[model samples]
Target chain A: MTQLVRVQSFSVSSDGFGSGEGQSLERPFGSLDPADLHAWAFATASWVGRREPGGSRGLDDYFSRDFSNGIGAEIMGRNKFGPQRGPWQDLSWQGWWGDDPPFHTPVFVLTHHLRPSFSLTDTTFHFLDASPEEALATAKQAANGGDVRIGGGVATVREFLAAGLVDVLHIAVVPITAGRGERLWDSPDELLDRYHLEKVPSVSGVVHHLFWRD
Target chain B: MTQLVRVQSFSVSSDGFGSGEGQSLERPFGSLDPADLHAWAFATASWVGRREPGGSRGLDDYFSRDFSNGIGAEIMGRNKFGPQRGPWQDLSWQGWWGDDPPFHTPVFVLTHHLRPSFSLTDTTFHFLDASPEEALATAKQAANGGDVRIGGGVATVREFLAAGLVDVLHIAVVPITAGRGERLWDSPDELLDRYHLEKVPSVSGVVHHLFWRD
Candidate 1:
C-alpha cells in the first residue's frame, strides 16, 4: 500500500483564511470563533469527543469520521500544539485538548525549540525542530507504512504544500469569511499546476474542496 | 416588483480572482484564458451566439440561460466594455462581442471619460462618468422596474457589493486557481452579516455560490 500524506477536514473561510491572526490561548483560531469555523464538523455524528449523543449524519458526518481513519502518525505546527510564541515558557501546557487527547498515534509538533517527548493516554507528543521535508521523513517512518496526516494551524500546511509534500488535501470551505487571519495561500492557483482539484458543496453550506496528485 | 440587482453565471478561479491583470483585446480576461474561465458557460446549451449546434444540457445550461432572464439593463465597468484605458483610443471598438451583443437591454458602461451613446440592434451602449450610486440610478431607470444586472470585471462587482446595492449574486467557483489577478474580496465573510449565503456544487467541478438578502 502506498503511504499517503493527507489533510482531512481542515476548515477555511470563504476568503481562504485557515485561521484568524493573533492566535493565543483565549483565541485558539485567532480572533475568529472556533465554533463558527468548526460547527460543520462538530455537528457531525462521527466527530470525536462529542458532548451529546445525537449529531447530524450524512456527508459531513462521513468526512468528519474519516479524519482518523488511516493516520498512523500526525504532524502539526507549534501553534496547533499550544499558544506559546517563542520558547516553551510553560511546559505544563500539554495542549488545548484535555488529558485524553484525540490522536491515538504519535503526534509530532514542529517548533524551533525542541523539548523532551511526553505521553498522555495513547498519544505521545514529540517536539521536533526540523524542516517540512525532515519532519515528513520522521513521521513517515513512525507511521509504520500507514498514512501520515498533516495536522495544521495554517502556516504548517502552507509550508508543506509549498514544499510539494502533501499527497491529498481536503479543505472545508465554510460560508463565513475571516476578515483577518492566517491565510492558507496568497493565491491557491499557484498549486494548480501540480494538483488536480475538485469542489463538492454539501447541503450544510460548506464546500468540500479536494486536491490530489495522480 | 422590487428592483433586484443580480450577478448570474459569473465565474472565478478557486483563489477568488475574477479576472487576471493586463486585460487586452486578444486576452479578454487578462493573462487567464477566457476559455478556461468560461468553458462552463460556453458548454451550456443556452449560451447566446454559440456557433455550434450542440452543448451540455444540465445545471450549467440552466444558469447560463438565467443570465438574460428578467434583466432589463446592465451596469458594467469600462474594462468589461473594452481594453483601452485612459481615453477611448478608437471609437470603432464597440465591444469585444460582435455586431449582435448578448445584452438586448441598455448597457451602462462606467468610465471617467464619457462618450456619446450608440445603439446596435436592440442593445444600446451608454457611457457614463458617474459613481456607482449615480450609475445604478440611471440603469434602474433604463430597467423600467425590471431587475438590473451587474456585469462585472471584478472591480465593478466589488464596488457594487461593498456599496450594498447588490440584491443577489451567483458566483461560479471554478476548480482552477488564478495566481494573480483582481480579487473580488479579501474575506467574503464580511457580507455574511447582511446576506444569506449558500453553496451548490455541480458535476462540472464548479461550486455555485449564491448570496441573497431578504
Candidate 2:
C-alpha cells in the first residue's frame, strides 16, 4: 500500500500564521497565548493529555479524534520538538509532551544537529539531518506501509508542501490572529494548481480547510 | 431609523489580503488576477454586468444578490475607485467600472486630493477628505435611513473596522492567496471581543465569515 503523507488538524491563525514568534521555555506558542490558538482542540475530548473528562463532542471533537486515526510514523520540525535552538544544550530535554507522548508510532525529528535514537513509551524519537525527500524516505520506511504525518511548526509544513510531498493537509483556521510569526505560505494559491482545496466550517467558529492530491 | 454599515460580497485571499501589491489600471488586483479572487462571484448569476446569463444559483449567488439590497450609499477608498495616486491628472478618469457602475447608490470616495462630485448613471461619486467617523457620518446622511456599504480595498475596511463603524461585515475567503498586498486587519481577534463571528463554508470552496454587532 502507498503511504499517505498527511497533515491532520494543524492549527493556523486567520492571518495564516501557524505559530507565533519568540518561542521560549515559558511560552510554547511564543508570544501568543496557547488558549487562543488551541481552544477548539482543548475543548475536544480527543486532545492529548486532556485535563478533564467532559468536553465538547461536536465538529471540533470529530476532527481531534481523527488526529491519530492511521498514523504509523510522525515527522516534526525541530521547534515542535523543543525550544532549544542550535545544538541541544542538555540531553535531558525530551519533549513538551512529558514522558508518554501522544504518538504511539516512531517519531522523526528533523534537526541539523543529530542525536542518538531514544524511546519513551511506544514512541521513539529519531533525529535526522536530511532534505525533505531524504527525510520522507526514512519516515516512509519507518511508517511500515501506514501513513506518515507531517506534524508542523510552519516552516516544516512549508518545506514539504513546496516539495509536493504532502498528499493531504488539514488546516484548522482559528479566528485569532497572530500579529507576528512564521507564516505557512507566502500565497496559498501556489498550491491550487497541484492540489484540490475544500473548505468546511465547523460550529465552533473555526473553518477547516482541506487540501488533497489525487 | 438608524443607518447600518456593512461589507457585502467582499472577497479575500486565504492570507487575508483583499488586493495584491502595486495595484494599477492594467493590473487592477496587482500581481494577482481578478478571476482567481472573484471566480466564486463570477460563477454566480447575481454578478453585476455578468456577460453570460447562466451561472450557479447557489449560496454564492445569494450573497452576490445581497450586495445591492437596501444599500443607499457606499464608502470606498480611492484605490477601489481607480489607481491614480497623488492628484488626478486626467479629469476624464471616472472609475474602473465603465458607463454604469454596479453601485447605483451614492458612492463616497475617500481621498486626500478631493474633486468635484461626478455622476455615472444612477451612481454619484462624492469625494471626501475625512476620518472614518466623519466619512460614516456623511455617508449615513446620504444613505437616507438605508444601510451604507463599506466597499473595500483592504485599507478602507481596516479603517472602518478599527474605528468600530462597521455593523455587519461579510468576507468571502477564497482558497487562493494574494502573496502580497494590503491586509484587512492585522488580527481579526480584536473584533471577537466586541462582535459575534460566524463561519459558513460554501460548496464553491469559499468560506464566508460574518461579523455582526448585536
Candidate 3:
C-alpha cells in the first residue's frame, strides 16, 4: 500500500564549501546564518532536539512540525551521505551520526558502488546499485503503507523529475541567492507548465512553494 | 576588477512542509546528523570556532582553516535573506538567527520591495531595487577586491551563472538524490564548458568538487 506521495526539495549553495562565503571544511555550512539555510537546517540535531519543547508555537514552528509527519522511507544520493572522499571503504563512516542516525526507518542510498547493507538503531541503510526507477521500486516495497521520500544531491533528483516520477514537491524558497553555484530548474521557459506553484506566502519571509506535475 | 568564478550546488529535503518532519521553533535545525550532514558539522561553533585551538590539522581541518580567511561582502537574493511575506512590517523578523548573526560584513539583499536600509553590526543590509546586475556591481564595490560570495535559494545562483559573472564554485556533490523537489543543474548541459573542474576528491566520502569558470 506504499505510495510515492511527495518530493520535497530546496537548493544549497554548493560552493562544495557549504552554505555561503568563508565556506570550507571548517564552516561547511558556510558563513550565512543557519536559519537562512532553512532547507538544510531541518537536518541538524539542534533543530530536531528543540521540537519537543512545550513552549514553542509560531509560523516557523508550524512548518517544522508539519514536514516531519508520515515519512515512510527516505531515498538519497551518494553525495548527500558524506565522507566526500570517494568510494566508501568499510562502511565504517555510518554517516556523520554516531550510533543512532536520525533517519530511524528504512533509508535507501542510491550509488554506483555496491556495498554490504548497514543498520543502526531504528534506521537501516540499504545501498542500491541500480537506476532511480529500481531504487524507487525497492523503497516502495520497504515503505509498506507510507509515502517514499526522495532524498537528493541534484543529479539524482533531476533523473526522477525528468522521468515524471515525483508527485508533489515543496520548496522552502529561502531569501538568499548564491550568485554562482549550481542551477536549479535551469530548465527552459517552455517547461514551466510541467508544475504549478501551489503556495508562496509563509512566515519569516521564507516562501513555501509547492509544485506538482501536470 | 570583476572576475568570474565557478559555483556548484545541490538539493536538500524539506518534505511538503518547508521544515523536515519533527522540526519546531525550539529545534529549528531538524533531524540532521552532524556526521551525515558534514557541511553543517564543520560549520558548528564547536568546529568553526576552533581557530583558537592550534592542535587540529587534517585535510578537513585544513579546508576549515582556509575557510576562515578574509572576505568583504555577501550577496543574496530576497528569498535567501528572509521569508516571502512581502514588504517589511517593523523588521521584527531580523532572520532565523538569534540575536548575533554570522555575517559581520556588509550584506546586499536583492529584492523588488522598497524598504529602508536595515543595518546590524558590521553587516549593513541593503535592499537592491534594481536587477541582479546592479546588485552585483554594488556588491563588488563593497568587496574592495575581496571575493563576492553569492548566497542563494536557487533562482538567484542560476541567474548569475547564466550571466557568466562567478569566479569559483565548489560543489560538495552530496551523494543523496531526491527523486523530485528542486534541482541544482537543470540548465542546458552546454553551459558545462563555462566551468572547469579544478579539484575533485573525497573528504570522508563526500566528493568535494571545485569548479572554476575561466
Candidate 4:
C-alpha cells in the first residue's frame, strides 16, 4: 500500500493567507482569528469538539469528518506547536491544545530547537530538526502502513509544497481575508502547473479547493 | 427612479488581482493576460465580440449579457482608456479597441492630462482630470437618469470603492491566480462589514460574487 501525504481541511483566507499576521501566545493564527477561518468546521456536525448536540451536516461537514481518516502520523511546524521562538523559553508550556489534545497518533514537530519527545493524550510530539524531506520520511515511517498528514502553520505547508512532497491537498477557503500574513500562494493558480484543482463551493460560504499531484 | 452606480461584470483572478503587473501597448492587463482573466466572459453568449454562434448560456452568460443593462455612462481610469500616459504622446492612438468599442454609453476617462472628448461609433470618449467623487458626479449627470457603470483598471475601481461611491457589484472570480498585478481586495471578507455578499458558482468554473452596499 502506498503511504500518501495529505493536507486535509486546511483553511485559508481569500487572499491565500492560511493564518493572520502577528502570531503570538494569544493568537496562534497571528492577527487572524482561528475561529473566523475555521468557522466552517466548527459549525459542522462532524467537528472534533461540540459542546452541544446541534451542528451542521453537509459537504462542509463531510470534509470536517474526513479530516482524520487513515492518518497515522502528523507533521507540523514549531510555530504551530507553540509561540515560543528560539530554544523554547518555557519547557512547562506543552502546547496550545491542553490535557487530552487531538491527534491520537505520533506527530513530528519540525523545529530548529530540538527537545525530548513529549506526550499529551495519545499524541506524542517529537521535535525534529530536519528538512522537509527528512521529516516526511520520519513521518511516513512512523505511520506504519497508514497515510501521513502534513499538518500546517503556513511555512510548514509551503515548505512541503515547495519541496513537492505533498500528494493530496484539501484547502478550505473562507470568505474572510486576514489582509496580512504568510500566504500559501499568491494565487491558487500558482499550483496549476503541478496540481490538478477542483473548486467546490459549500452553502456555508466556504469554497473547498481540492488539489492532487498531476 | 434612482440612478445607481454599479460595478458590472468585472473579472478578477483567484488571489484578487483584476489585472497583471507591467502595463504596455502589448499587454493591457499589465503582466497578466487579459484572455486568461477573461476566458469565462469570452466564452459566454453575451460577450461583446464572440466569433462563433455557440456559447455557454447560464449564470455566467447572464452576467455577461447584463453587463451594459440600463447603463448610460462608464467611469474608467486613464490606463483603461489607453497605454499612453503623461501628456498623451499620440492623440491618434484612439484606443486598443477598433472603430467600435464595447461601451455604447459615454465613457469618462480619468486622467491627470485631460483631452478633448472624441467619438468612436456611439461610444464618446471624454477625458477628465477629476477625483473619484467628481468623476461619479459627472458620469451620473451624463447617465441622464440611467445607471452609471464603474469600468475598471484596478486603480479606478479601488478609488470608487474606497470613496464609497459604488452601489451594486457583480465581480467574477476566475479560478486562475494572476500572481502579480493590481489587486481588488486583500480578502473578500474585508467588504463584508459594508456589503452583503452572495457567492454563486457557475457550471463553467466561475464564481460570481455579488455585493450590494449595506
CA lDDT of each prediction against the hidden true structure: 0.83, 0.82, 0.54, 0.83
Worst 10 residues of 3 chain B by lDDT: B10-19
What is the C-alpha DockQ of each candidate? 0.03, 0.03, 0.01, 0.01
Candidate 2 chain A lowest-lDDT run of ten: A53-62
Tens digit of per-residue lDDT, candidate 4, span A102-210: 7888999998898889998888989999999999889899998888999998899999989999977889989998778888878899998988676778888898887
After superposition, candidate 1 runs with Cα above 4 Å error: B1-214
TM-score of each: 0.51, 0.51, 0.43, 0.51
lDDT of 1 by residue, A1-214 (tens): 5688988889999888989888878889878888999999988755877866666544565467667766889999999998988887788878887888888899999999988899999999999999999999999999998789999989899899889899878788899978898988655566779876666667889977767676
Model 2: per-residue Cα lDDT at residue A48: 69
Model 2 Cα lDDT, one tens digit per residue, A1-214: 3567989889888888888889998888797787888888997755765866655534465467567756789999999899998888788888887889988899999999998889999999999999999999999998888889999878999999888899877788889888798888655566789876766678877887767665
Tens digits of per-residue lDDT, candidate 1, B1-214, equal 4677988789899888899988888888987887898888887655876876566544565467567766899999999998888988889779886799999999999999988999999999999999889999999999988889999989999899888899878888888888898988655566789876666677888877777766
Q: Between prediction 2 and prediction 3, which has the larger TM-score? A: 2
Clashing residue pairs in candidate 1, if any? Answer: A177-B189
Model 3 scores a TM of 0.43
Candidate 2's C-alpha runs over 4 A off are B1-214
Q: Model 3 chain A: which ten-residue window has the lowest total lDDT?
A: A53-62
- Model 2 lDDT, full chain set: 0.82
